[model samples]
Target: MSNNNLIKGSLQTIILKLLEEKDRMYGYEITQKVKELTAGEIKITEGALYPALHKMEAEGLLTTEIQQVDNRVRKYYSLTKSGKAEMSSKMNELHAFIDNLHRILNPAIDPKLNL
Candidate 1:
């Protein structure tokens, strides 16, 4: 599996977290921010990003604003009230998932038993 595949499941959580940090962001800006934050370890492609954004918008988890920038219209996304609540829930779930994965990957053995 590719790195993109690994990021696929966490994409929603990632996007939610980013938007939580920033009030609003455009598609390209989001892709760039993820690259910068991850130090190029993960790259979010347009194909993957757009569909996710659209789905979230349809689900009322996101609200969009269109603005004119240099004669071009850019759509910026911000979390709705529902989205904020969802973000908190998703963040908690992601944290628990990471903790579980860490435990499974680096399990601790009983000191007395030394198994």
Candidate 2:
């Protein structure tokens, strides 16, 4: 399976971090940024990303601003104060998860092999 597929649980954290670093970002930009950062390993799909953005906005974790771009009104999302705080906790959780997974998955690495 392609790691480009984001696990739903961690998606919110990644989105929040991106928005936190940048003042605001539009949906496609967000998708592209993640794709680029992951070296194309993780591709965020419109079907998944849009609904997540909407849900985050509805939950007050994010807020949107709109401006006309190329005759189209594009919505940009930014993190709310709560979102900023949440990012720290989420990042910690994600790291813990990855560390735990690593230990579990590679319990018997050959000691001599330099792998």
> Residue by residue across 25-82, what tens digits does model 2's lDDT show?
9999999998899798787889889999999999899999999999999998998888
Q: What pairs collide in candidate 1?
A: none
TM-score, cand. 1 vs. native: 0.91
Report the Cα lDDT for residue 93, model 2: 86
**Model 1 lDDT tens row, 1-115:** 2377779999998899999999999999999999999888889999999999999999999999999999999999999999999999999898877777666776683434322
lDDT of 2: 0.84
TM-score of every model versus the real structure? 0.91, 0.83
Question: What is each predicted model's overall lDDT from 0 to 1?
Answer: 0.91, 0.84
